[model samples]
Target: METNHINQSPIDLESLISGLKTEDARNLKLMLNIQSMMWGIAAVYVFISALKFIMTTSWYDKLGGFLTLVAFVAFALLFRSYYKEYKTIDYGIPTIEMLKKAAIRYELFQWRGLYVLAPLLLEGIGLNLMMFDDFTNLEPLNRILFFQISYFFVMVIAFLVGYIIWKKRQKPLRDYALALLKEFQS
Candidate 1:
């Protein structure tokens, strides 16, 4: 890139450092808030499911609520684990080396974050497996139709979320990191 007669001078080191720190702090707060909200939502679902399990007359709703309650609690645990970890990341220093190290560590954290989603994936599969009885009680045609329709919706939503994260989040983050860290790479 040409350096001469740019519209504006490059950002000062202090400004860059402060900007990065602010960004990290803001990101952490947002993450923690989201996790807390997820936990809250899961807890609410668990309560609702418990009420349904106790008060409902249908075998289907009872079993379904109990199973869903388990899944929501599992999700709450996942969020709690990551929330604790997010709470621990501190602003260390404003130096370039420290920032570079922080960036690398953040990348590792992102990978480790996959563990946070494992419970959801496992529960999703488990729910399907355990749902045989849920289907068996219903009429054959309705069972097959409903199951297929639910799975179709789930798969479409999964695909859309995956595509969105890859395109809007992952790619942009990778590009931003490469550009931002280029100066410190020696």
Candidate 2:
């Protein structure tokens, strides 16, 4: 009589880590795309708004508003995609989980800061334009002042959020990478 035995293979930690790295790279690319799209939209909006101000007409106002709305929608979609990706990770894979958590924290900071601060800054600019009677009355000095103030506010908020996320995730990311390296060596 002959007996049959079943064979089991060990978990391929290197392959697992490689896969995690690939996923992280993909997520980073997506994040960069989202950021680029946001900046592009913002630049276009600023240009349109400036043209409207210089022309001293409400004709472009509707188009500007529509573009702003589209940008907001695009941001919302990106946020949702980020949230979904963050939630779908397998925590059993400790290193991958840590990386995913770091990504989630970064994305959360970006979403909150950009969504809240950008609109507030834009509203301030719109209000300033409304208060000025005409483009000629909005002197170069006044326009520069408004632009600088709003830019400062947005930059400060973005920097603060970015710093917080970096500080919070640095240790975890390092530990995760080290752990993965150890696993690979063993």
Candidate 3:
């Protein structure tokens, strides 16, 4: 009786490293595209606000200014958070690689939620405030306060949704990372 043997080769470390580098490059490109899209949205917002200011001479402009400032602050915070997370992953500290990946995923979810929620919240506030101009019976202060409250509620909901998504996505990644670490150690 004759038996045939099949030979399998192990994965090459250099090839693994090259593959990782390519993935990193792709991630960097994706991050750049996300950033560009964010900036483009911001630019459009600024242009629209500038047009509103040029055309209107009302207290609505004050509300617009406040909303714009809020947007800028939120964007700055989100961008900074994203940059920090990106740096953590890009630096590749082997000890914390899994943690960094987890952080990146969380940050991405948070930023995405904020990106969707911010404009919705802003539009809600803007519309509510605009109604005040036409509704002479409503006090300006009351309208502003109502808009703020509504905005806060929307933000809370957005964060909750993001957190739920993050929690769901995190489990598999955590398990995979733990398994990888265990295998490496053994």
Ranking by TM-score: 3, 1, 2
Residues 1-186 of candidate 1: C-alpha lDDT, one tens digit per residue: 444434255656667879999998997898778878877887787787778667877665666556656667776776667567646656675555555544554453367657646555555544554464666778756765676578668867987887776767556655565566786565
Better of 2 and 3 by TM-score: 3
**TM values, all candidates:** 0.49, 0.43, 0.54
Report the C-alpha displacement of residue 97, candidate 1, in angstroms. Answer: 19
Q: How far out, in Å, is residue 150 in model 3? A: 2.7
Per-model lDDT: 0.65, 0.61, 0.66
Candidate 3: tens digits of C-alpha lDDT, residues 84-120: 6646654456755765466446443444655856755
Which lDDT value does model 2 have at 131? 43
Cα RMSD of predicted structure 3? 8.1
TM-score of 2: 0.43
Q: Kindly indicate the candidate among 1 and 2 with the higher lDDT.
A: 1
Location of the lowest summed lDDT over 10 successive residues in candidate 1: 1-10
Ranking by lDDT: 3, 1, 2
* lDDT (10s digit) by residue, model 2, range 10-123: 666667889999998997788778668877777777776666657756643544454555546455565666667655656667765565455555443455556655554554
RMSD of each: 8.9, 11.3, 8.1
Root mean square deviation (Cα) for candidate 1? 8.9
